[model samples]
Target chain A: MNTERLTEPSKDELASGLRRLGAMDPGPDFAARVMGRIGTAAPLPAPKRRMARVIGWLMEPRTIRVSPLGSLAAAACLLLALGLFLKINPGAESGRTPAGLSPVTFVLAAPSAREVAVIGSFNGWKAAGWTMRNDPATGLWTLTTALPPGSHEYVFLVDGTTPVTDAAAALNVDDGFGSRNSVLLVKNGDGTAL
Target chain B: MDKPDNDRDDAMAVERTLSGEREAFAVLVRRYQGPVYRLMLRFSRDEHEACEMAQDAFVRAYERLASYDQRRRFFTWLYTLALNLARDRARRVAREPLYRQDLDMTLADPGRDPLASLEAARLLDALRDLSPKYAEALALRYIEDMPLDAVAETLGVSMSGAKMRVHRALHMLRELYGKEGKQ
Candidate 1:
């Protein structure tokens, strides 16, 4: 391989060489194979417009005809039955871990913050239920909760107003608003990150 | 035909396909299949994988047709999708040993000099050593013979950015080839 002398090839030579490299034939049946695969695959579902969804919801028939005393009695019975069920299944009442959910600790260090919450695709970007607790000693807010094993994009809300990304996150994606959101990849029960 | 005419034809095809004529997409497939396959082949260096990726790219284009902006050229959009797919495939097969296709066998001219063929192969090998962005920029510019503006459009960069990428890529290629020569 005596390619030493040919190291500094002219620009035209490089262009011609690249042109040669890119000239492979893709064979005759290429289009046919692609069309065949398309025929076998399922067609994409029609996208529903917002107006259609609203119309569908509005058109759905509902019946509500109950006496006030009967409604109150039914509500009371439902509450008593829920209390009995909770008494029997204490773990369910205590919010026991669902199957296939791995515990992931979300930490944000905001010393001066009054409140901090983690919001992401997993929780519909809701800050109400996924609030973090602050540690007086380290001033680091932490929340350890079970998230389904997958990649999740999250942002930390400081004091219920400011949105901040976790600096410790390994991956980040644009939030489409000139800001970035951190990404967390939770491994499965077998310790495999997907 | 002129470039604008080609772009108009592509836009018309997209309009027809979006209007429920699925066969209109075939027009697009036929028009771009060669260049898309060539781009994928440059990335994977495997004929079979390139074909699969090209087909997959067309299928994806059809599926995501609604998302396609009519203002852009169809081939540029399609080429970008194919490039991303090829990059993903390359990443998955990164650990596998690379099998370089023999460039000499596919030449149309039998009387071509063997030494030139060897040199071409060495240049391609040096190209493979460059980063994907740089190599892709160079390939789209030189191999596909795309204009700087088209290259910029395909790469989602400004014309000046595309020019810078090509310059940097060529510089890297020169360094790589020079080092290989010394070895």
Candidate 2:
């Protein structure tokens, strides 16, 4: 593929220059600006969806990790994961909350909108009993309710008919109606909120 | 993202952010501004566009934090999300013009990158000529210093696929550099 041989920069040199791009920095106020958009002392918590501390325990480069540990250790890790999953996610497949409902909180930060409601698979996509409570001081709308441990899809219905996507959702799926709905997994945890 | 020791700290910060700690989320933003900003630069027409796109990516990631698979690294997830936003931006904004222009512009405007070596500049110029996917593969592999597995995970490709892309990318970059010999 070489029409003319070039020896200015070898592969290693080219690779080195490319890697230097990784060190480019942004403006000093970058973080503050981001916070300004999210708010510093707002009235409500960031959003309803959050914190998989256990999940973030694994970082990017760790994907290639291979330990010389025996298969027994692997099995133990698997068993621990399964136990943790079952413990953290009781309402996973059953879609029922026999161990009692988990408190699931959802927040929508819509200041301009006059009304907001949450409609999802749990409520059959209806907002009848899911009208959200708004705080004028912060203009953040919040809704905390108990749901059986399981997966759920929802959206914030701003005003009355316009559906808005939850930017804070753990997962968002196609709504099949030219829009997207946020997804959340409610685990069978303690008195803590999901 | 590569720092194993930071994993626990990242987890803690992420947990705080998820728990509605806005300030905690700022820690992540401040921490990752460098690589994230650099990543967005490839997809933008200029630094301003890159900055806007990078910020948008973070806000979107914050919005979709719940959707993130915990098994993956936060930076990986954030990088993937930023790439998606860049793609979406490409469709809507219709930008990412020729890379040679960027080279010329940066050289002419010494304030932009006064320290850029000619060799380094030419290499970057050729890189931008490759297709987005190929460039992305090379960037992830060499620039980001990601393992093949991490590159595969970021690109959503199998390990073999990642290897193939990298191979092809290097060949293509070599051809482009050869053409530069005429200049």
Q: Which pairs of residues collide in candidate 1?
A: none
Candidate 2 residue spans exceeding 4 A from truth: A1-8, A40-194, B1-3, B96-121, B181-183
Residues A28-124, model 2: lDDT tens digits = 9998887777664432333333354444554434656657686679989999998898768644534554457776778889989899999988999
Give per-residue lDDT, candidate 2, residue B151: 90
lDDT computed for candidate 2: 0.75
Indicate which candidate wins on lDDT: 1
lDDT, candidate 1, at A96: 64
Best by TM-score: 1
lDDT of 1 by residue, B1-183 (tens): 788999999999888887878777778888788888877766665456668889988898888777777777888888878878877887888633234445554232456677766666667668878888898899889877788998898899999999999989887887777776676
- Model 2, docking class: incorrect
Clashing pairs in 2: A91-A149, A167-B63, A168-B63, A170-B66, A170-B67, A171-B67
**Candidate 1 chain A: 10-residue stretch with minimal lDDT:** A1-10
